[model samples]
Target: MGKANDVQFERARPRIWDRLYPYLSILPALIIIALFTVYPFVYAVRISFFQNLLTKPRSHPFIGLQNYEEVISSYYFRSALTVTALYAIAVVLGVLIFGLGVAMLLNSNIRLANGLKIIILLPWAIPTVVAGLMWKWILNSDFGILSGILYSFGLISSYIPFLANPTLAKISLVMAHIWKEGPLAAIFFLAGLQLIPKELYEAAKIDGGGGWRLFRNITLPLLRPIILIVIVYETMTAILVFDLIYVMTGGGPADSTALLSWFAYAEIFKSLNLGHGVALAIIIALITLVLILIYLRLLKTEEINV
Candidate 1:
């Protein structure tokens, strides 16, 4: 009887090991993720409740929601919110228009379509910081390639300071953002366009549907999912934009381009107030989360309606 029990126990041990093998295989990755992602997020949240100032680093008193209150009540917060909203709206709209246009053009059997398709994604391939630097150089007040081209054509009496004036700076920033982000959106749209059945378009044409009619009815409806995705993604990107501002505008020319993320950076490094920065960052994250949730709810309703 004892020998039989020992053999049964050994068999059960293998079964238990098999059950835990999958979890053990992924344990290392779980540990790494916790250490990097989870730990930092928790730490940031904790830091936001303290008085973490470089000037008084020796005393980090518990401040509760004071950091959040001070940051929210400031004038800079209002300005940053406004700028961020405008920038997000403009960039999302511009990217959608530009992307849809490019995608439609690529889908058509136009001359050099293949070549254009290959070249169009180059901007998206470049790093955001590098793209911003490139744009900065192109729009430089003096001796910029764009200014040189315009001067050569006698379009302006003098080279325009694209980054100096508040309005021009905002426009230039928007243009740069569209150029950098439009390519991915175009690719997304193109993929959606390709998935659409040719038969649908053919039938619409047979039913006397012209280009605009077919697009308004068939193309738009079919591409609704892709459009929503692009909107959400572009909105997030626009809200969190920092590298471009850092490289191109530095939130300058009278703070016309100082976005919320830029203010967060300023609070942390420039103002040397870690608690304020963390709180602002948390606010930004919450704003993004709320927007995403709203988008997801709309998407669900859309799916249900369809």
Candidate 2:
């Protein structure tokens, strides 16, 4: 009886190990995530409830939600919020239009389509800081290539300060952002366009559908999912934009380009107010989370309707 029991126990040990193996394999990754992401987030949240100024590092005192209240009630917050809103809206629309147009053009059998398909992704591959620097040089008031070209063509009396004027600065930022991000969106759209069956277009043509008619009915409907994805992604990217602003504008010319992220950055680095910065960071995170949830709800509704 004792020998039989030992055999049964030995057999069950392997079964138990097999059941636990998958989680054991991924335990290291879970530990790393807890250390890096989860721990930092919780610590930051705790810090936001305290007066964690770098200058007074040894004297952090619990201040509850004062940091949140102060950040929200400030003038800079209002201005940054407005600028962020405008930037997000313009970027989303610009990227969508540019991406869809480029995708459609690439899908066509034009002579330069192959060459363009190769070159279009270059901008997306470059780092954001590098792209911003390139645009800064291109838009330089005194000796920019664009200014020189315009001068040679007699299009302007002199070089324009693209980064100095508030309105033009906003426009220039939008253009640079679109140029940097539009390529990925175009690739996404092109992939979606390719997946669409040629037979559907042929059938539509048989039913007397022209370019606009076929696009409005067939192409647009089929690409709805991709469009929603692009919108959500681009919206988040636009909201969290910082590197470009740092490299190009520095939130300059009267804070016309200061975004929420930039505001948080200024609070943390420039002002050395860790609590306020963390509070603002949490607010930004919540805003993005809400937007993502809304977009996800829309995506679900779309899927159900289709």
Write out the backbone clash pairs for model 2.
none
How does model 1 fare in lDDT? Answer: 0.96
Worst 10 residues of 1 by lDDT: 1-10
Looking at candidate 1, what is the lDDT of residue 97?
A: 97
As a TM-score, model 1 comes out at: 0.93
- Cα lDDT for residue 38, model 1? 90
Q: C-alpha displacement of 117 in model 2, angstroms? A: 1.7
Per-residue lDDT of 188-286 in model 2, one digit per residue for the tens? Answer: 999999999999999999999999999999999999999999999999999999999999999987899899999899999999999999999999999
* lDDT score for residue 127 of model 1: 92
